[model samples]
Target: MTSPATSDSAFTNNSCDTEKIHILDLFAGPGGLDVAAHFLGLESTGIEWDANACETRYSAGLQTIHADVRTMRTERFDELPDNINVLAGGPPCQTFSVAGNGAGRRALTEVKSFIKRLVAREESSETIDEELSALGDPRTALVLEPLRWVMAAIENGKPYKAIILEQVPAVLPVWNVYREVLESGDLPGGVKYRTECRVLHTEEYGVPQTRRRAVLIARLAEHGHASMPDKTHKAFTRPKAETAPTGMATLDEAILKEAEHVERPRANRKEREPWVSMSEALRESSKKLGRSEPYVVVSNYGSGGDPKNRGRRTSDQPAFTVTGKISRNVVETPDGQPLPRFTIPESGILQTFPSNFPWRGRDQAQQVGNAVPPRFGAHLLAAALGLEEGRVAEAIEKMDGWPQISEEERERLRKIGCGDKGKCPTKPPHPQG
Candidate 1:
């Protein structure tokens, strides 16, 4: 595998010095972070192995390298250009997700131990790979791929200036362990990173879903001030019931009726904006599809440990966590009239992708479901790079309506930088809102 030729051109669109910050995204599913990078006028290349997702990336004119991250370890690290000073990725989370088999959660202890050994150089790469192979599912070991690349880059004398990683909430402990090793300067070149890891609520970041992700951000110790981004929106809270009035059919009925009357928590405008709701997000799509009435989403799966008790959320609330099975959820009007489930583009909207983002190939639902919402990614990138809040807001505003570039324009932009430039916008005009 050969690295794409480096370019010194500056992206004149945003405030960041684009010539100095290039990102390499690993396990980059469907170009979520890459979209965020592009909105910020930063150059990025995604390494994804899924053909379906690669097809979507190709259609969207994003830069991509169709390869497994594991193969990029060690000597292959040299194949990456030296201009890549930033590393960002959300590795496969199937094993760690609640919807998954939990193989990664079960192997957390072993994975943590491997992290220590790798940082200390206590074992050969082959030995570690052999042990990792025994961990039931092969994807379980992919979570550690980011750290391996970091170590490899340090040894190659090109340590990334900033590193951003994210996965399911269950991976927080793993990130905690990473925080330790990274800050300890125990790796090959004794590079010390100022790191922070925590579980972030997507709703607080303005995504129209209530997903939680474990995020880790690190910067070279000398870079100064590395921390999680501040919440830009208020968190979503379930509505509570108020006391029933004098005339009521029954306690249950009264509770149900009065719940809507109860005041939900609200954020002071000076503090943060209110959390985005499903209705607001789908409003445009609903209008285009001629759906104006309120609806409820009846989940396909069980809730509260009872298979019969399916979870339900009204259109007014933020959506429940979106999974690959999103298409399986049922949508119905308040009066029990059946409605169409969210379309692929609607699901992408809920995940904070632009409504017009070109989704191609098979398992498009999975690609949308698994993506890191571009709005959320922009916040994380801004915080990690110490950009101003205004810059983050600007990037997110553009995401509200990402334009669909023409095929001819896409071909021209795709040739701007390296042969595999994911989202290198030379002068991405302000997209129409």
Candidate 2:
């Protein structure tokens, strides 16, 4: 279990009773967190870059800004409504991701440049080093991005009362940096926070996906006694004589299959054509897209438990960590062709993203491969929003209007991402909201 952030117990919150929360989603790829906000009837705005993602956001009627967050001024955002309650998201984790850590290491230089978007130039690197010195050391510098923004908030005396972040376990090494740079720093007032993180399984959070993410929440409220969000779902798997059934969600149970009556364009069939064996799509996509060589799941395994468990293990019980490099190989095909690589929609389902959610970018594989599922993002948002227990369920209402695809609409989408061949499995075209 991950330790709780410094001390949510520090103080009881009094402001939430008096106001509604507005969210500013940062590095907000496809707005998974916002989807939860929508369900709750809350309003949110997101910043994402990628033509496809932009198109998706607009089509969904979300107030989205298509821009590089690292290029925008974090401080300038204060101009947004004062009711803004939370800042939440799983930032682009590529620079901190375990897969292609070599790629991450090389990309760190670009990631580091994002700091300028937060800290003022007058703030010396010495100041940053000094503050970080007080917090714990992080495995990768990517941990500092959130801290930079949080520290800036405190420096400006306009801190968002709460902050939330999500990533994979590979990001834990940088905890010390968070403690020192953000928590340990002296803020405008006595305002300071403690950091805590846990490795959380998305399946445990009620999402069918077996995604495990590192979750952290920081609060301005003093830590007298903090409270962790209660888990709503228990772990389940196939029942065994020796072990009780671990009723884990099958890939089928987890995905939202076709919406009934999707005829004439009302069907919500979001689930991929039920896990077609790698008969033709794979071979044809291979030939058409020249994807002849099988792709790899690039990452490392944990030390404890079976080391073999660290790498890929095909099972109905658990899934390999999601990565940008999904392949037909993770689960394996009957013909030994590897598990059929997910269509972007299937990838989103695995990530707990809702159907009809749009993804942006020329690289469908890379974007879905890198995104945090919205369903999981919703949990983190619930924690950040300090939502009342039963109330969190209300957020699903926000998706009630998540737009629909008509037969005409689906055809239009297939034309853009797939063309005439029907081999491309990218996200649907953005149906303008």
Candidate 3:
């Protein structure tokens, strides 16, 4: 496929303009950040090679270039429009994820070395490419792709005004290296960015899942602060069973003391809301499915890989991290009566995608698992663009449904056999205990 830069029609078709913030999302899987950008009233074009994700993007009417990021040369930026001022992406995180083999984690040292080399211009691109290939898994090298694009943009004399990147928490060290390089003032242009990198809890940002991501935000030094957004919800604490008071303490007295301690923080509680619970987040799903009883989710995998020690959570708590194996999880009433596992829409909802967010193509579970939650992305986008808090709230409200696609666009996607009708199985293929 041709690079989006050469295909000026991509920008023109999307109505990209200089008046508003426009984002170019790299490795933009299935329009997660694009959904947030759309709701926030920003234009974005995502570059992705995965056919599965491209199908979904087309169905959702998201601006997309179905090409690999690695193939898009740095020189392509010379042809890109001036309106695409922001850069945002969440690179593939499999090798770096805690649940996956630790290839990326093991290669962290080598990756950092590569960053230093790139910043100092100590090695040619060909040499660095050979070194990166030597790393065990090819995906491990992708963590540094964003840095390459950033340097390329600067060299092209069109540095982005703001940049946002996120991945599994294990990638924080990589982002720290990015922060160092961006702020080092050694780029082709003397462009400097005020940067911050930190691990953010999704539940702290109102996502109904307890996912943690390492995020980096950088803004041109001429721009104001580039801080992470303030948390808008209280952090989730796992529920613990109550035990009878020991020794001289009576049960009532102990209960009273515990209540007082909890109440003490109430005076300042107005600053943030309670962490969103699974029941509250999935309320609409439950009602639509005609399930009135409370339920518990029994994880498919064990807590830390022990088959006998499966994890369990009630509807009152935020969901455990949603993963590709989400269909393997068992949902049941509190009394142990089996209920259906979450459908595709429900799974997307847990990840903060709209319930009707048109999910299509293969490995739909993986798509949901890999996406940067739209709610979380909105906050990141707002902070990077220096937008006010109200913008985030407004954007979130718009996420209740997917964006409406025009009839002409729908026909265009339909001709390519991509439409709003999602083909992925909603229910699991077979029953599981």
Candidate 4:
């Protein structure tokens, strides 16, 4: 078990009043956390800036305030239902992602300094605005927006009962600062919080992707304490691993002989199932596309520019973290014959979105790539609320796959379509809503 951010007692909140709680999700991209809250039967009001994301959220029947979170004040939240007691969000991570340029990397020092100032009650709105302008990338400072909201809520005496946050592993240190401040009573008031921060591999929670995120959960209630959820599955086996990392099962040479690709060894006793492979998730897409044998997706860019970093994942394994430029992943037959890139529907499935979940507006890929897998979010929210994971089953509404495309649509796509480096279109022309 991960250590608590404070020396407070580990209070297993057995309060059956979880249903009375609602959530206010910040930087609420397409309602990822809201979806999870819904699965736990919790109502939510989300604030987001992206027009496209708001459209998608509204279409999904989620409540949303289509505006920048920075403009949100305590007064705006006052209009929400009185049941709002949980605050959750995953900030835009482009600046913090290791896959990006060094903008977020360079801004880390200043961001940390800003955190310290906030904890010291020295950061004013004018100072914040000036420093945010200096950072060049405004999103880098967005990670601190949740802290602002929490502070505002506390001052208003409407402190949240629970708080949940997620970001790339690069943001772990920032969250650590948050952990210390919340638990050490470093805020403006004497209200110390119980908190825990850890890096969680999504595959271990049964997400069909190998994404890892820094998660922090805190609660202000007297009996409130939060910790990482127990792993339900094992980590995906790497192409090469001399030793297994924590929470990952060790695979001996003998176990590697059972199949062409090694199944991630089971770690927990609760569920011994293998990690869900990309093949398992897109079996129908493979059949429809007339490709059943194993294949490779070679991305145009990877962690860096190294050809060795050409982000490649075989069908038998969970996919690498999908990115905003996900369409750049080029598919090729096992024998090295080039094929098309992944279709939008296939990409949505990789992100664990419903098959027919409508992706609205331009930059659709970014919306899908940035979303938290609803499945993973459900597990985290359920665990935080001390509720049975079974509650999510009834809440998940299934949908159909991509609608069929007409020849007219096909022609239009071909005329305007291109791939990374001007390659041919991946999936056939379909409606881009």
Best by TM-score: 1
Global lDDT of each candidate: 0.77, 0.49, 0.76, 0.67
**2 or 3, which is superior by lDDT?**
3
Q: What stretches of model 1 exceed 4 Å from their correct place?
A: 1-16, 238-270, 408-433
TM-score of each: 0.84, 0.61, 0.83, 0.79
Cα RMSD (angstroms) for every candidate in the order listed: 10.5, 13.8, 10.3, 10.6
For model 3, the local distance difference test gives 0.76
| lDDT per residue as tens, model 3, 31-112 | 8899999898888888776678877888898877655576554424543457777899987887877666667777888988
Candidate maximizing lDDT: 1
lDDT by residue (184-239, candidate 1, tens digit) is 97877688888888778899999988887888998877666467888889998744
| Candidate 4 ranges with C-alpha deviation above 4 Å | 1-12, 74-77, 240-271, 288-291, 303-309, 392-433
Better TM-score candidate (3, 4): 3
lDDT of 2 by residue, 1-433 (tens): 2233333232245224313567777766656777776765567777665656655655555666555443333424544455555666665554444343333333343334434423335666445544433333222333555665665555565676667777754443333234333464454455655455555666655554446566676655442222234455655442222121123123112211211112233234232222211222233334554444434331234322233433433333334445566543254433455544556654555555554466544666666666666656666666655566556655543432366545566445434422453332133212101
* True lDDT of residue 285, candidate 2: 33
* lDDT (Cα, 0-100) at 355 in candidate 3: 88
Q: What is candidate 4's CA lDDT for residue 159?
A: 73
Better of 2 and 4 by lDDT: 4
Mark the regions of model 3 whose C-alpha exceeds 4 Å error after superposition. 1-18, 74-80, 239-270, 411-433
